[model samples]
Target: MNEHVPDPAAKLEERAKRKAAKREVKKTEIAASTLDALKQLGYANTTLRDIAAQSGMSLGSLTYYFTDKVELITYCVRLYKAEFIDRIEKSVTSAEGRDAVIDAFADELTRSMTEDLPTHRLWYDIRSQAMFDPAFRPVVEEIEGKLLETLTRVVQAAGQQDTSAVPLGYAMIDGVFRFLLQSRDRHARDNDELMAIFTAILRRIF
Candidate 1:
């Protein structure tokens, strides 16, 4: 019996899959490094070289993937938004009532603030830059739209009658989160405090 050999096309396909997978892993690593750098050095202070060092990649390799800081920042923002939406889905899915939805929102927000405050801070940094930077506006708007959609769903689930309350609810949460990001007293921004404040705001809106 003759031994079987892999087809050239099959070999090429497998190689392509492996390459794509590796690229995705690298992208995830780069995004993580970008967030870390933003947290440590801030958006204005962070350079591509800083991200490259954080990611443990050569600057040339990083540029091959990201081209520039703007592109890299946009990619990281989308990655962050994707993770956030996933968490929102899980948090809100099992909620049974308005109060339950509010609880879910509060829990998720508190968890995010506590577990990954750096990413939240990175988000605010980019979000603020988006206001004046035309290149950043589209992604920022897209992410904010998705966030508002989820917020609206939560508000509607919580028995909110007013349509306007959706944006209002988002504004409330955004304000508090921003305050936490900028607070001088870091110890005061506990999960319990966040939950209480979010619950009260949601109750008022809904």
Candidate 2:
């Protein structure tokens, strides 16, 4: 029997892979920790030091993973919106019919607005900033495009062959969402109103 030997290059490569994986995990942990702070403070008011405090890490340590607030916020928002889209996709997929899809979508939207108001507000804040700062536009546009795609999927799953109305449908939904976010009385009545609007929009699209 011949003795097995580990290649030095392979060992080095494996170590590097582990290190990169560890770094990514740490970055995600930091992002999750700082998300609520960013949501509460808004992008303009937030800094890397603030994020560090939120993550319970020193500023120098935080800067090792993310150079600045913009980079950190961008990563945080992308991670959050990716999860948000995943939820919408899952809800839409589980519904069996057109009406069910519409209801699921509307219910999810209502749940998100009512339960995660601060996060949604942060999203809008970043979107508004994108108008004046080019740095924010790419991520903003990417997220909006994904959201539109989700809306389109919802429409198509609802048996709407004429997809021309999808864009208008998305705009209607977004407008309602933004309006509700700013509304002071976020009672069940507001949710009921949103459900009604969503039903009407879905029916019209179909």
lDDT of 1 at 162: 72
Which ranges of candidate 2 are over 4 A from the true structure? Answer: 185-190
Candidate No. with top lDDT: 1
- Note the clash tally of each candidate: 1, 0
- Model 2 per-residue lDDT tens digits across residues 83-198: 88999889889888888988888788877876778878888988999999898999999999998888878878877777777778778778878887887365444677767766
lDDT of 1 by residue, 1-206 (tens): 98999799999999999999999888888898888888899899999999999989899999988889999999998998889878977898899888898789788878887787778877888888988998999999999999998877776677675778677768877887788767825556667887887778777777
Model 2, C-alpha of 196: deviation from truth (Å): 3.0
In order, candidate lDDTs are 0.84, 0.83
Ten-residue region with minimum lDDT total, candidate 2: 183-192
Model 2 alpha-carbon miss at residue 9, Å: 3.5
Whole-structure CA lDDT of model 2: 0.83
Could you say which candidate leads in TM-score?
2
Please state the error at residue 82 of candidate 1 in Å.
1.6
For model 1, the local distance difference test gives: 0.84
